[model samples]
Target: MNEADFAALRGAILALPYVRMLGFDIAREDGVLRGQLPFAERLIGNPLVPALHGGVVAALLHFTAAAQVMREARMARLPRVFTCTIEYLASPDLRDSYASASIVTRTRRFANVRVSAWQPHSGKTIAAATMQFLTGQMD
Candidate 1:
């Protein structure tokens, strides 16, 4: 995604009540679809480790992948998630989070997307996901 498209997607998605409450943000850098989650106390699952909830991390990955598919397909409606497999590489810290996604492959009706999430640095990915979506048949 480019800056203009990214801005539009970011605006639309960010305006959602849930997304806004959670402080979710979408960014584009170097034509990559990126998602961010600002840390909140309610988001912490393991207070002992101060780790973010697994569901939170997974959400970022899911949104990033879907956003990429949406941009690439230029869909009029949101794509439907068929399957999503997430790998937890490490526990996330109680801080801001980030993720990036790309479309691995796509047909007229189906799309495969890959996503990676990290806290401090891109190389230090804390989670990754491979997702398949139904890009067609919105009707």
Candidate 2:
């Protein structure tokens, strides 16, 4: 994608209400899309474990996959999430978390994406997700 297209995608991502509420910041590195979820008190679901909420992590993974599809496919509109399955590998600590997505397959009508999330280190996965999104013709 061109620089202008990338900038527009970034703007759209940050403009999403839930992404903004979660303080998610997105960036691209060497053609790869990455996202960060800043540490927030509201994200803590289990007070006993004090771990980041599963929903929050799942949201991050979903958003990451959607953003990847939008950027890589150069789609003008965000695709509809058809289905998603997330696996929690480890409890995330009270710290910033990062996620990256890989587009596994893309057809005219649908795209499949795999996402991995980690805190502190990318080598260690906290959660993983496979998502399928309904795609439209690229503009």
Top candidate by TM-score: 2
Give Cα distance to truth, residue 113, candidate 1, Å: 0.5
Question: Which residue ranges in model 2 land beyond 4 Å of their true spot?
Answer: 121-123, 137-139
- Per-prediction TM-score, please? 0.88, 0.92
Candidate 1 segments whose C-alpha is farther than 4 A from its true place: 1-4, 121-123
- Measured by TM-score, how close is model 2 to the native structure? 0.92
Clash total of candidate 2: 0
Clashing pairs in 2: none
Per-residue lDDT of candidate 1, residues 1-139 (tens digit)? 5567766777767666777777778877776667889999999988998899898888888877877887889864457899989999988888899988888999988999989999875357899999999987755
The worst-scoring run of ten residues by lDDT in candidate 1 lies at: 1-10
- For candidate 2, write residues 1-139 as lDDT tens digits: 6788888998888888988999988788887789889999999989899899999999889888888999877776668999898999998988899999999999988899999999875457999999999886445
RMSD of 1: 2.1
lDDT of 1: 0.83
Shift of residue 90 alpha carbon in model 1, Å: 0.1
Q: CA lDDT of each candidate? A: 0.83, 0.88
